[model samples]
Target: MKVFADLEEFTQAAGTELGPTEWLEIDQQRVNQFADATDDHQWIHVDPQRAADGPFGGAIAHGLLTLSLLPRFMHDLYRVDNVAMAINYGFDKVRFITPVPVGAKLRARSVISKVSALDNAAQATLVTTIEVDGAQKPAAVIESIVRYAS
Candidate 1:
């Protein structure tokens, strides 16, 4: 993980690549829990037996489930010390590029794409990409925004 002394230190490092975070498995249980929580009970994501013959050849995780991992991945990527608060301002862009089949392992790498000043804070946009282990394509790409305050 990369540690910045403060938000100002973080702003000066634009285009820096933060990490390919520790691998995380996408299991059926996690997928099911996400489905139950979000009320997205699609057969392709919840019904393993039915999904085996579906387009992806097996159950796959929801795109939103993958998107939700942004925070988890970012925690493993970088940290800014001496900040009183940090907030997930929002995402500027997001795209699900690949189907994340059940039992797949995923990891993320992020680039500090842009940064802008804020009152007692800084807003940064990280272009984060999540890739399925051994896959040719990334599972998702997102421009995640965060606000760090002193």
Candidate 2:
């Protein structure tokens, strides 16, 4: 994990790659829970038996399910010690590049793309590329913003 003493230290590292987070397994239970919560009971994501002969050869995770993991990924990726609080600003861009099949291990490689200092806070934009284990293409690429209050 990368630790920054304060927002200033973090801002100084803008345009630098913060590196990849720890791997997380995408299991059926997680996918099912996400599907139930979102009411997205798509066969490809929930019905494992029927999904066996589907396009990806098995049940795959929903794109949003993968997207929702950003918080956990960021938590494992880095931290700024001097910041009193951090808030998720929003996403500038997001793309689902590849399917994440059940049981696949995923991790995110993050780069601090931009940073701006506000009156009482700092905003950072991170370009996170989530890669699936052994896959040639990333599962998703997202530009996420966060605000840190000192």
Candidate 3:
């Protein structure tokens, strides 16, 4: 993880790709829990038996379920020092390019696109690319923005 004691330390290091987070497995139990919470109990996401005859030949996780893992992904990615708190501003862009199959392992690669001042706080945007292990393409790409206060 890259530790920045101040905003200046972070802004000076733009475009650098931080190391990836630890691999997180997408299991059926977790997917089902997400489905239960969101009322998105779609067959492709929760019905393993029926999904076995579906497009992926097995159940797959919902895109939002994978997207919701951003916090865990970022926690394992990087951190800043001397910041009182950081709030999620929002995502500028997001795309689920590939389906995350059950039991797949995934991680995120982040590039600090820009960091700018916002009154008494600072806003940082990161182009976070999430990829699945052994997969030829990325699973998702998101422009995540956050506001940090000292």
Candidate 4:
């Protein structure tokens, strides 16, 4: 993991890849829980038996589920010390490029994009791409914005 001493250090490192986060398994239980919480109990995501006859063959994860893993992935990738707090400003661009099948293993690769000042705090954007293990394509790609009180 790369540590940025200040905003200047982060800004100067544009296009540099920070870290590859640990892989997370996309299990049915978690998918069901997400489905239950979101009230999105679609067969493609929750019912494995029924989804086996659907488009993705077996049960697949919801696109939002993969997108929601950003914070967890980022936490494993890097950290900015001495910050009073950090807030998720929002995502700039987000795409679910491919489906994450049940039991799939995924990890994130975070690249430093831009770091600038947002009022009294520092705002940074990280372009994160989540790739499934042993797969040729990425599951999701997103540019996440975060504000940190320095």
Candidate 5:
């Protein structure tokens, strides 16, 4: 993990590549839980047996489920130690580029695209790409914003 001494340090390193996070497995249980939480009982995501003959070949994870993994992936990627708190500002752009099949290993690569100073805080824009292991295309691409308060 890359550690920054403070928000200023992180800001100074804007345009830096923070590298990739460790791979995380997207299994059926996780998919099922996400489905339960969101009440998204779509067969493509929750029914393995029926999904075998469906579009993705087998059960696949919900696009939002993969998108929701951003925070976890970012935590594994880097940290700004001097911040008292951080908030997920929002996403500037998000795209579900490819399907994440059940049991697939996924990881994310992040780049600090921009940083701006706010009142007693710093806002950062990060371009994150989540890739499926052994797949040619990324599962998701997002431009995430975060605010770190002093």
Candidate 6:
């Protein structure tokens, strides 16, 4: 993991490449739970037996479920010290390029694309590319922003 001395150090790292962190499997249990939480009980995501003959050949995770792993992915990448708060400002653009099937291992690589000053904070834009093990295309690409207040 890369550790920055402070906000200035972090903001100066505009072209920094953070990680292709350890992979985490998208298990059926996790997918089912996400489906339950989101009330998206789609057969392709929840019903493993029925999904066996479906398009993906088995149950798959919801796109949002894969997207939601951003926090987990970033936690393994880098950190900045002495920040009082780091708030998720939301995404600028998001694309679900590949379906995440159950039992597939997923990991992410991040780039610190830009950092701009706010009145009481520093806003950073990270380009997070999530990849599925052995897949040609990324599972998702997200441009996420965060505001760091010290």
Ranking according to TM-score, highest score first: 5, 1, 6, 2, 3, 4
Ten-residue segment with the worst summed lDDT in candidate 6?
115-124
lDDT of 2: 0.94
- lDDT by residue for model 6 (1-150), tens: 889888888879899999889999999999989988999999999999999999999999999999999998888998878888899999999999999989999999999999987776789999999999999999999999988998
Query: Model 4: per-residue lDDT, tens digit, 42-149?
Result: 899988999999998999999999998888988888877766788999988999998999999999998878877666578888899999998888999999998888
**Candidate 1: where is the Cα deviation over 4 Å?**
none
Give candidates' CA RMSD values in order. 0.7, 0.9, 1.1, 1.4, 0.7, 0.8
Clashing residue pair totals per candidate (backbone < 3 A): 0, 0, 0, 0, 0, 0
How do the residues 32-141 of candidate 1 rate in per-residue lDDT, one tens digit apiece? 99999999999999999999999999999999999999999999999999999899999889999999999999999999998888788999999999999989999999
The 10-residue segment of model 5 with minimum total lDDT is: 10-19
User: What is the lDDT for 64 in model 3?
Assistant: 95
What is the Å distance of residue 25 in model 2 from its true position? 0.9
Number of residue pairs clashing in candidate 4, backbone atoms closer than 3 angstroms, sequence gap of 3 or more or interchain? 0
For residues 59-142, could you state the per-residue lDDT of candidate 3 as single tens digits?
999999878988888888788777789899999999999999999999998998888876767888899989999999889999
Q: TM-score per candidate, in order? A: 0.97, 0.97, 0.95, 0.93, 0.98, 0.97
lDDT of each prediction vs. the true structure? 0.94, 0.94, 0.88, 0.87, 0.94, 0.93
Lowest lDDT sum, 10 consecutive residues, model 3, at: 7-16
lDDT of 1: 0.94
lDDT of 2 by residue, 15-79 (tens): 87876887899999999999999999999999999999999999999999999999999988899
